[model samples]
Target chain A: MNRNRWLLLPLLLTLLFGFSLSLGSVRIPFGQILTILAGGDATEPVWADIVWNFRLTKALTCLLAGGGLALAGLQMQTLFRNALAGPDVLGLSAGASLAVALIFMGQAAGIRLLYEPSPWTTALVASGGCFAVVVIMLAIAQRLRDNVSLLLVGMMISAAVSSFVGILQFVSKAEEMQIYIVWTFGSLGSLNWPEIAVLTATLAAGTFLAIRSAKALNAWLLGQHYAQSLGVPIKRSRMIIILSTCILTGGVTAFCGPIGFVGLAVPHLVKLLIRTSDHKILIPASMAGGAALMLFCDVLAQLPGSTQVLPINAVTALIGAPVVIWVILRHPRMLP
Target chain B: MSPDTPTIALQTHALSTGYNNPVLHLLENMSLTLHAGELVCLMGPNGVGKSTLMRTLAGLQRPLAGSVTLEGGPGMPPEHQVAVVLTEKIAGVNMTVYELVTFGRYPYLDWNMRLREEDKKIIGQAISQTRIHGFTHKKLYELSDGQLQLVMIARALAQDTAVILLDEPTAHLDLNNRVEIMKLLQRLARETGKAILVATHELDLALQTADILWVAGKDKTLLTGLPEDLVLQGTLDEIFQLKGYDLKTGQIYHTAFRNKTVALHGEGYLYRWTRNALERNGYNIAASTPTDVTLTIEPGDRPAWQLRRGTATNLYYSLGELLKALPK
Candidate 1:
């Protein structure tokens, strides 16, 4: 049964990739698509550019961002030993959103900008700000022994950052408001190759670190004291988890503007499907499951029948919220 | 016995265990040894450091000042020498008895883990030995308290350690289940040659089953010896701080009524037997009753004892005793 499931991952990935690439507003023939991807002759320049540059980049962005978010969520779940814990629960994405809003709305009037550079450079600054917030939250969680209090503090931090962004939106001019609103909706069509490279590298590093800590995570499931008796360095393991969560969450938010629900929902879906919490299996399963779910949502977002595209966050919440409600009602004991 | 007999399965040298700066000392400067193939009971009143001692022996808590050495015997690693079952419920309620039992193999398996044939056999034997083989596929939450206790013991058995420690394993069980659990432990000690240590408040049951007793008292001392020796030497009474007993009649009446006394008379084997029965029933067997008391009895071939204003007779003897005393 396990081997068959392992084999099914790549098959599902290929099918999702193929379906995502084929269904768009403009339909390109399979033969022509293949020729264009292979760097061969194209009947028209626009069709070739749309297939190679626009749609393909968007698909790859979904793959990277989805995998990164889900892996970060899984690590947070094990670290907190709470099923509801996720990347957004730590306020990292809210911090990035606030930083980007400050830059886009020209709210940094008094403070001199360090560097006037490209969009990627602005994203780097935002990622650094997000990581700072995550570090502060991690330190606070270490000091507070109670889980509920830690969750409340994270929510308060998120609300504080969100209120600051709301003020920025109120004062901004018309064009800046348009840009901020578009960024807030969240899309996979914005990144270029350089940003994609950075996202991929960060996700790979974070995933590797999480996988290496799988045995320690199993020991921790028994409880903190039992894990200590098993010779796990609790402080060091917690630091590694916090650092990995920051990298994956900060990287995805830097590129995709705080896409919701994929980080929170994909890990849960993978665990339900795989029936195991061992990260050796859960990490890769979450990576593939997250990518598939994101691509499926992306395909829905680009409603081929209509000219309008739904927001990615709206699609995720529409699918994620009902499953979350059902999970809570069915397994109330698993909430913590 | 040799001083260096090498039979000590666990030893503590001046150990102290407590939480947060060691202000509330649960255990203090305690030194003791648990030998192999012995059923040791740790008996104490509530809040007298029984659980704390078990946790320290299991290495779940660090001692404030001492070392616990697990002597490797019969070719097992020091890490595998001790297995503990705590009073707290296991966290994985969804896991089956089989899966939970297999978790004991965690300390032996490698990173890319798979249970070997020998591991499976050991787990199977543990399940059968704990009498949970019939419920091996059932989830933990579906079992009763006694059944769950057996599953926990089965998990500990699968660990294949030389020493087993349990902290109040029978605290939630009924009377029948408590005896069954203690009997299982005693059988395991004799049959498997594992040194079993359990902390419990069931003093009489411990006296029946345990070979040695580790008594923790409020005086901050730990006393260890054979259970009968501890009782015969009056060490158990000293630890409990009990007073007010009649030595000649072997009666323990209320401590507050020290000046109150009752007297009765009888002779021979039947007399001694009846006197012991009266003493156990809370009457001071003496030469005579007080003149102010009301007494009731029926006529018999021999003298009879009875409660005041009650119809019940308290004197009886076996046919053998009667025949032996008949006009010889």
Candidate 2:
């Protein structure tokens, strides 16, 4: 049964990845899709252009951001030893949101703004916000004795950063607010190759860090003291785990605009299918599962008959929240 | 230490330990050593620094001063050298018994957590050692409290350390479970040749199971000796006596006894309980049988107590009936 789950997860993920690529506003033929993917010429070159430039990039972004945020969430949940903990638990997304909000609403706040509304500039400011929160959290972690306290501190920082964003929204122009609000809705399609490369690099770094600390994460299941007794250097392992969480969470938030529910929901969702809490399996599984769920949600966000796409954030919550509820109901003791 | 002598598996030198947040110091300037194949129980009343000291020894908390070492090495030993079964509840972990036990092989396994042949053998032995093979596939949340405690001990056993420390392994368990856990710890210490230390509130259980008693003293020190010596010397009474209970005589203060002193003759477990029943009813036992009332015990499948009161003999089958027939 366990071996079957291992085989099934990737098979399901591949099918979703293919299905996500196929379903856009314009209906592309599956033959042409495969042909275009194989680097062959399509009957209409525009079909190849559409498949290469838009759908493929969007689908890959879904894969990277979804998987990254979900892995980040798993690290946080295990590190904090909390069921409700997610990538946003350490205020990374909130910090990125604040930075993006600041950049979008800067002119209305009587600040001189030089940047264009390009993905690069937006990503730059979002990254700035993410680092700012990381620095603040690392500083607080020094004085704090326990992870629970640090988690509480992260929540407080999130609250403070959120209030700043709320105030910025209140004074901003409708056009500026619209930009910020749309960013909050989250995006997967706007990124070109360069941004995706950076996202991939961040995902790679975070996944590496997570894998390096997989044993520590497993030992952490016995709680902090037991983990320490098992020869895990608590401070170092915790820092590595936190670093992974920050990079993965921040990278996704920076490029994709603070995607919701995926980070908070994906680990639980993956565990439901996999039936184990072992991080060695969970790390890769969650990444694949997160990617699949994101693709699935991105497909759901597009209106069935029209080009009008709902907010990616709304689609994830609508989809993620129920799946989590189902997971919890299926096993009342699912959370740790 | 030489191989001929018992190895000092764990030792602490002048260790002062406690929490730093509230600035409370628990144990002060204490030196203690634990030898291999010995199970020592640290006993004391509440807030007596037994847990703080255990935590200190387990290397969970930093000592205010001094150091704890395994063998002749400095600082704490690695996971392969020492294992600890803590009181922390493994709640909502979503791991099976086998998975949790496999955690004991953390130091042995690589980053991927794949077990070698020997590692698998060690884990199997640990499961059988703690006798939790029955539910190896069951999730932690599915097990009862006693069963979960056994799983935890099994995980520790899988560590295969020379030194093991358990903090209240019997806590939150029923009477049978309590004995089972303590007995398991004692057996593990002997069979594995490990130096095991237990911090517990179970004075009676500890007295029976521990090879040595480390009683927390009034001056923030450990009073270490054999269990019988500690009990006979009234060292065990000092702390528990504050609650008006005597550990030496196994009697409570303010238990008013009747002035009647009866001579009851008996032996073995039944005799002991029979004497207990008589004493509970305020009747005293005397060495001299020439006193007013002499009750002779008749031992059999169904034991009987014979009462000879000035040549008027009477017999009762049960202690309950005999006590009732006598005056209050």
Candidate 3:
């Protein structure tokens, strides 16, 4: 019965994304938006720019970031076997946040950096920082056999990084603080074409690696000893999964700010829906489900007839928290 | 003996087993050959490394020193020759019985592999053989512990290896389930001609069921022989000390008696039934009698009796038949 429902997913996603582009304080007609998207002649250049440059990119950014975060989140959940495990839980997002904070604070202090940086350059640096933090966490996880202990260590690292960001925020000037605050709020609107290109490339690579590790992950679901018995190189598989999660999450955080909940919720949703732990189906299902969710949430963030736009995190929290609470109430045993 | 005697199904050539750097050996300088069509039971007390030895044999954990070799003859690779059912529960609860059983195909599958018709048929057969056919669609978490155990055994069966190793497969089961699982293992060994090795603490059941007893003693030496042979050699008494003496029949009990005064007159099949029932209900049954009852009425007669000034109800027949008249 639900198989037919799956067939409707792509159609629903296209409709949701198309409808989301027309939303905002200044409403653009759907036909004109389509015309502008097609790059044909248009009546208003301003409206064309607004639809083509702003909403389209923002919507696409949400789709990609949502999918990427969800995939990473699902991977982390499986690896740790903890429902609460997410890419953000490992402090990767905090790493990006801290790096961005440093850049803003340094600029505010009137220090002339060696490199002339663009927004994309800042994103790249942030992604590098996130990668470093993930590497550290992976190293620690490898040494610790206990999953809860590994989670606590990751939480401690996240806390430490957040404190450092706090210190940076304290020393920064008002204008710099404003820039940092806006970045922290997390907006899909800020990703330009260059950042989108980078995001797409990183997501593609991470997804490919995840797919390759699918069989190993299935073996891992039986525990490390069983996986080893099945001829899986546990350490090597762990490394690949960690690397993929870091790259995918780091890229999203850099370009679109640290979007939350999508990763944590999307995998669970896929598991709940498909009713199987097999990653062969799960990985692709999570990607599609995550993309649709992000697009939906982004559209909700820009409520029609309102001048004010909601923070992406706030929108995700609004949607994700209820589902999480419901999941907890229904199947409390699944929680670690 | 010839050097090549159709190579034993599983052999530990001077194998020493332990965990974490091999500081303390569980079984040292141990060498044994288990051939196909044998049911071997590893009997020992707790912490005797029966589980560890099983793990070593299953290739889940490495021995501290020495090696385990699986001789190829039963249509399987040497590496894939052993299948294991450990005491630990399989991790995933969301998986169906069918899916869990199909995982036994792991060693046979290549990258990007799908289940073949042959694999499906084997899995289906295993499910049926384990008597878990009705629960195929049920999630593992929904099944009873005994049912889950059968599923695990079915998974091992699906692996289709020559050597099947079970580490305390009956550890948590009730007596009935324990005997059922043991019988299943025995039947599998006989029917499929596979070597089945089980490590268990149920000495009486193991003695009755196993073809060969692999006794792991406190001295860390493994002795393998027929069950009756081991029993006759005082191995069972040496490992599990006999405690009580019977002065009348020269019979011994592994446990000491607390209350030995109660006895009644009984004889024949009815007497046997009464004895078994009384024993099960925590009353001792002895051959000699301390009290006698007179049967003076017909089958429908209910007479009165006296025991220490208290009157009790009685039945009419031979003492054995009267005892059988009591409610079960």
DockQ values of all predictions: 0.19, 0.64, 0.37
Interface RMSD of 3: 2.7
Candidate 2's displacement at residue A43, Å, is: 3.1
CA error at residue A94 for candidate 1, angstroms: 3.6
Per-residue lDDT tens digits for candidate 3, residues A151-250, read: 7887898999988878777777888788778888788888778778878999999999999888777766766655655656677888898889998999
Candidate 3's C-alpha runs over 4 A off are A106-117, A141-149, A170-177, B1-7, B21-27, B73-79, B220-223, B234-273, B276-328
lDDT of 2: 0.85
lDDT of 1 by residue, A55-152 (tens): 78888988988888888887776666666778888888888887777777764444335444356866786798688797788788788754457667
What TM-score, to 2 decimals, does candidate 2 have?
0.94
* Worst ten in a row by lDDT for model 1 chain A: A108-117
Interface RMSD of 1: 3.3
Highest DockQ scorer: 2
Clashes of 3: 0
Tens-place lDDT digits, model 2, residues A1-336? 765877877897889889888888888988889999999999998999899989899999999999999899888888887777888878898899988888889778997575677788888888888889888888777677688899988898889989998999899899999999999999999888888999999889999999999999988877889889888888888888888898898889989999888887888878777888888889999999899889988888875665888889999989878866775676454345
Off by over 4 Å in 2: A323-335, B1-4, B75-77, B242-244, B251-263, B282-294, B308-312
> Ranking by lDDT, best first?
2, 3, 1
Cα shift from native, residue B218, model 2 (Å): 0.9
lDDT for A119 in candidate 2 is 82
